[model samples]
Target: MAGARFITLFVILSSACKVNSQSSLLEQFVSADTTNRAARFAYLKKVSPTDTICLNDIKRAIRDSSGDSALFVFNVDGFSTMLRYENELAQICKSNQLKFKLDIGTDIGYVDQTTGCYQDYLDLILFEKYGKNFKPDLHKEANDLYLANHLLDTISSWDCDIRPRCLSANTHTSISIVVDLPIKAHRKEWVVDKKPMFAVYHPFMDLSVVIDKDGNTSGYQLVDFIPARRQNKKYKEQLLAIAIQEIKNKYYKWKPAEINGVLLNTTHVMRLEFEAAAISK
Candidate 1:
């Protein structure tokens, strides 16, 4: 009886020591990123397969340091918007480092992850589900879909790098932001609009655009309107209608978003700031 009791105590102590050692390694990893600026993620990658403890520690550290507090706690909250918190966290991570990985750690539990980015706006769509996953067609243009071999999955955290949404990742890094570089489609380029007053009146609007797979504006609704100056009632009615008609006329000029070359019939909200030169028909 005494021998059994001794062995039990020894096991407990061993587990405690193991946990502490892993925690110590995590502290070093986080510290090195800040103080030991030379500690590369490549080095950590080499040690991850054999050292799951260190990898798991680093993974959790990434969450604790970068994960959204609301998402971790309020996943089921009725009034909060925190779906796909892991993707948001992933976005933050890749914003800092171009090529990175998450979920290298073993754990009792981990945040469920998906390669799809479906915001609340998609709730009304007639979607088919494969258990927790929706049809890949719905998410063909998601932000997370741009990663290398990305998937519209329902599983653990990113096994690969997570970067900007809808933007191609090759050679696109932090340096691109500071140069005023133009991005490809899915992001809009503005025009000089409003022929009535080339300098005096300015207007801006946000349109909730539903672009079909054919890259045409299937439908749209004005979400926001800001007119530089208030016009009379008749003019007000005509003004917004003209703006609406102007956008609808460009049906063939738009680009649809996609993933892995698969077209996505998704909704996009666009903000437009118009200059005096472009609004006239």
Candidate 2:
């Protein structure tokens, strides 16, 4: 009786594994034909009844090896259908207690030319905010950074009644310019100890500066100073001091940002690259 029971259990497990393998393969076929709703539904019906296959079950079967599921909906479908599908997936995630995120890929078409232009304008503005050292990866955190600085409200209130103008004559051409960051100097022009020198190492110095309504620097703080190369403890301090003095000697100006014709306290980031130059006798 014991031997017969073991054989029954083994047979049941083998059949279960075979079914799971076939289900997984079927899910791959469905995922590959994302744009073909009719095909996918037919395959689902072949596996099980349409009424029995819920969104959650589809999510489970088609989930990648990392245990994450992604659904790609084509824009060829009307906006209503796209939204409806998204809502269904969202409902499934909530009911199943699953973490979900939605990313719209480049394949999605813009509603109009104006919408595309508006997106480009926003990108340009963000580029001005980060200056010449803008990193594309930092765009993900831009919203949080803008919110922390209370800039969103200020930007929304900008006077679109006419072409915007700077608050002062010294205002920079870039709308979101930093007023205290050093300009890029030619290597030949960079001098130390009153002698022309070549830079052996250069690194970026990250700083934040506050600008008042008058386009003047109110305060400055260093967030980080990356050294070009490692140095002795004493030399490091000396190099840092030199970098500080160099930045302090530079001048910066930006169009004072205003909201509804009222000047607001504004803070901007400055990324200064400091080079360690050595003069050869």
Candidate 3:
């Protein structure tokens, strides 16, 4: 779990500018993390401060454990995974029934191939179309008040080359595919009722969720996190604890992923955005 231990943050413990480091505020926060050091077990990996893509943290992990129902990776390559193009890509994954991964690059293996839409993923990044439209990777210019927003839009008119079956051995069995619609069509999503002031700490946090066959959350894990360039390690445990709780409270589930018409357990990786403004008002 040493990998997980070093991970905490996209929760703050660094620069005063990355978060509201007021002693009164941070000291007031405490959790089981300090007493038990539980974060060591749940932590994923610390990300490079220069990287803006939130999904970069867990992309590789998702690819590895995807077979045998280890995970169901969510598509997180756009402005808001639940909002615009990311949403669209996720739906596409659902419809295609290909489980490998979306456009984001994988940490373990190469994705640029005709097997699934990885070729398209490479095309999207090489094009870098979203940067012109959304102006992502602006965290350097951000502070405690307003943070940079990374908007990724990879869905273009090329039509995904992904098919139900790919020539690659791993593609069809890949668990990195995004989960489809809810079991019940009427289930609604929850809006952020209160935006956190400390959201400026990092761009996002990677979340790992396991859904049972019944379309319910069966497991949750912290895969990776994004942090500031010079983050403060003062209230690190407290921040980690708070962020975990925030996700547990905010997450919702509708449907579990199915392949070959079998309802099986699935794991999904979600890049939880901490940049408050990235969410619509």
Candidate 4:
């Protein structure tokens, strides 16, 4: 009798363990498909644009498919941006009780909206809040660098109005150009750790204008990268132009050979000599 009771208890515990293991397996990452229909539908209904039901239709596809379960729309807007605001979408994921890790590739959407806060914070911590007259030498270097790199061809500039507070379809419609962030440069490298240069911030190469069907720009995203080699080509040409202009303005009285070879006659050569002197110091 004792042995039989012990065997029964062992079976009961083993069955419970197996059930728990199965539950764990159920929660693993799933692809965008039917099994995760419920969660996907919830997110669409919550965030989809009101004017068009295309996003809703996409969600319905998952519902109709057999055993397809993915948490978020994998294609439209990359996953990283979604995850950054996951708190807003947490309800759908929690309701589904699905186990998943979001694999949204590098976020290049360039939709930063905290301009006021960012500017205020930077002013408070990084630099003294000075008006237009308070230009730093670093700003001059950055400006020169940009002009030297982007002077060739027609560099396009646009004043875009981005709506940060607006997320839903209704708000997307109401987007207005209140204020804009002043873009400082194209290719810039800020020192993160002093020893090895790490590129922390870089402006996007391609500009994607996200406007409504009405032609009013709601938001814009930057994509595609202009390669470094291409930028270098433009930079060399621009530098040459600036050098010629400066020489003509300041030292045109001297002959070409003297201007090219002598100090103070050519800004390009003078800058080179100055750099060499600094290095020798």
Best by TM-score: 1
**What lDDT score is found at residue 258 in candidate 4?**
16
Error of 2 at 166 (Å): 11
The models' CA-based lDDT, in order, is 0.33, 0.35, 0.31, 0.26
Q: Candidate 1 at residue 99, lDDT?
A: 23
**Which lDDT tens digits does candidate 4 get at residues 28-147?**
111111232333333433442441233333444344332433332222112211121233224333454421223222213223111111111222221223332222322233333433
Lowest lDDT 10-residue stretch of candidate 2: 112-121
Writing each residue's lDDT as its tens digit, candidate 3 over 1-281 gives 22221122112222212211332111211210121233221222333343333234345444554454222232222121121123433344344442324333222222221111222232223224333211121111111111111112112111111111212223222122111211111123344666433222333446666545554553556676544322323333444455556545444443434322334454555554333223222
For model 3, give the 10-residue run with minimal summed lDDT.
139-148
Q: Please give the distance, in angstroms, between residue 244's alpha carbon in candidate 2 and its true position after superposition.
A: 4.2
Task: For model 4, give the RMSD to the true fold.
Answer: 28.6
lDDT of 1 by residue, 1-281 (tens): 11221232233323332311332222222221123112232243344354444455445444543433211111121221122333543454345342223222111222322101111111112121122222122222222434333333322111211111322222122111111112111222344564333233345566665655555654566777665444322243444555556556532344444433444455555554444322332
List candidate 1 segments past 4 Å from native. 1-201, 232-236, 271-281
TM-score of each: 0.32, 0.30, 0.27, 0.15
Q: What does each candidate score in C-alpha RMSD?
A: 20.7, 21.7, 25.3, 28.6
Off by more than 4 A, model 3: 1-201, 232-236, 275-281
* Overall local distance difference test of candidate 2: 0.35
